[model samples]
Target: MKSTDIFLEILGCPSEEMHEPVNAGYICPYTSDRCSKRGHGTNDPFPVCSIWKYTGARENRRKDRPVIVCPKRFYTADIVGDILEHVWVGPYERNKINAVREIKMGKIGNVDMVVCDTSNLPALDNFVSVELQAIDITGTVSDVYTSHLSQTDLIRSPKYNFNTANVHKRYLTQLIKKGYFHSTWRKKIVAVIQDVLFESIRERVRFAATNPKDENTSIVFMSYTLDPTETDEEGYYRLKLKEVVGTEHSVLMNAVVYETPPSKDLFVAAIKRQL
Candidate 1:
């Protein structure tokens, strides 16, 4: 029933002053301070931590799900605990989890975060990699944000579409390449994302059937959703763990690197039409 919502917070600041500067404070659980990210062309912080998807393609409006646009929003929930249960971290208990951010691997590239057993530090052999991703938005939500700041109603919903294509073209390879490397050490890498993203991925690519419990598995996917019914003292909905599944390097390999192509005749027919 609800539609067109802009979810922004000034942390401990009163709800009435949300549109104004966060005079009281603006602390992020991840950064333990104000959100590190700043909006383009302005020093003002990007106000959208998340938003309710009201207007979009017919298929996208099925549930009016809460879209997690910021990576830090994932930090509000117990995502680490959820990952620990499935990752193949050797002897890394909850207390021993030493999370290092943006650690660079030689050629494979920088991983989002690496969870390690501090007890096994120096060597750092006992660890699992982590990649936290929120879907990239196509159009700017600045219009909606401005409207909220003015406390004026919006005449129309601007295009704030989620860039689902990145799931295949951009992020998929990062997972496969890194997942394969982690597999070599007999460790698992976790892909942390929201439900909307995971659903879009599965629809586009075929997933290989595998269990996270299986020692051979290399990739783990942890999907989450916001619980519309539950809210904290701040009145923001609580994020709940919805599902966790694991796959292997090969499963992800098939996602983009290798795929079945259309028949040659079909290609020729399309070329003929263009000619």
Candidate 2:
């Protein structure tokens, strides 16, 4: 591990200016509450929105790549608000649409949020379920976090790897299942994810969503990339929407089930190397 392996891209609320986490806490832009998500064994909220990784010369000479680690990182702006325009259906005004957070359907797993058509008072139908997913880290970085917050140099560098495959194996399955479930209800499901995470899916999963306006599109993915050069008045980097993919529930199912497999001997060759 090297000292440059990890960089905290965001410490507190992504919308606010960077500040020390010792005295006061920064309110989570998503929750509008004290940042509740924490690292292991820490009482106070561990407000790490995202991180930048520097892989050694083998991967690249040296390049800084940002990866969002927290779902709240997607909340610097109303993602669903933007999603509404992309996936909106019916005659209701987009402004009148309400974004509902955290609704659990029996055995379907909890949805992070859903966009509702609030035009009809006391009724919340024609809703679209939304899920926010970030990458799961493969290695520990708490030690790195402690040092960064303390404003001290690392005693020893800690390396962390993004578990992109984990997303494909577990998370994508859940998303497809949820997508199918929503399709049964004749509704739409949207997944908000980072660009890097989506790239991993593009590698392993076959997806070809041509038009967003297609009524057949029951599953929508809106991917964003962190814009380093652009920032709000508070100096927090902007999450620019990079791409939107629209597909049917059945399309997603077939894509995942029929993903192109690698050459048969590729794994065996690697095993031979070990032998």
Candidate 3:
């Protein structure tokens, strides 16, 4: 689907754009020959009124520089001293909006970029902790045993401390505190398990004395098994599992639905359509 369609579905309108320019024709550019104030900007050399100034870069301009114009109301404000909203239109524009999140577990740090919708803000608050499991059917533990030896030595290898000051953990915390995740508790739990399993695999790799050179490479393959519901001493509700056997890493990662603000014209049009 077109990104714009997704945008409209989420934000309910087009994305807002600022600083467009409009052309003036066959009249006093300043007031378009309708102004009662003759003294203001009347001496301006440009054919287009100073009030209707072009705000776009030369690259953004059409063949006619006067083609670029901001909203009439925004320009009128310069004379009448009133502020109004502005808008723009382009077919191929890519909206550059996203949410950045960071999560850390002992020695492992993760940064995730989540794209947002222009309409939904509340969805940003929910996420599921995904846990992964390594697929090994040997039962003989030969490969597991070989890897375990190598992992031990690697864990003791020197490592730089990671920076995580800007990471926002509130989203995960709120999801757990609120009940929105209750609907997907089983899925959430499986996700949490995946995280724990990965951490375990990492720890095992660190235990292996062999250095893989780059720390960023994945040492093992893992996958998720969805378990959306859990029942226990605490009354069962949708739950995001937090622990796996013995590990310090938090398996809880949040999933959020995001949105951008609607375009000014689309917003106004919607209001008019309703009225």
Better of 1 and 3 by TM-score: 1
RMSD in order of candidates:
3.6, 3.2, 31.3
**Per-residue lDDT over 33-133 for candidate 3, one digit per residue giving the tens place of the 0 to 100 score:** 43222222334222211111123454672211111111111121111110000011111112432323334322322322112223335554322222121
Q: Rank all candidate structures by their lDDT, best first, as comma-separated numbers.
A: 2, 1, 3
Please write out the lDDT profile of model 1 over residues 130-216, one tens digit for every residue. 888887788776766666667777767666678989766888888888888878888888888898888888877777857876788
In model 1, residue pairs whose N, Cα or C atoms come closer than 3 Å (at least 3 residues apart or on different chains), thus clashing, are none
Q: Which structure among the candidates has the greatest lDDT?
A: 2
Q: Which TM-score value belongs to model 1?
A: 0.83
lDDT of 2 by residue, 69-125 (tens): 888778775586677677777777857877778899779779998888777878777
What TM-score does prediction 3 earn?
Answer: 0.14
Q: Candidate 2 clash total?
A: 0
Give lDDT for model 3: 0.23
Task: Evaluate all candidate structures by whole-model CA lDDT and list the values in order.
Answer: 0.71, 0.75, 0.23
Better of 2 and 3 by TM-score: 2
Question: Clashing residue pairs in candidate 2, if any?
Answer: none
Q: Which 10 consecutive positions of candidate 2 have the poorest summed lDDT?
A: 10-19
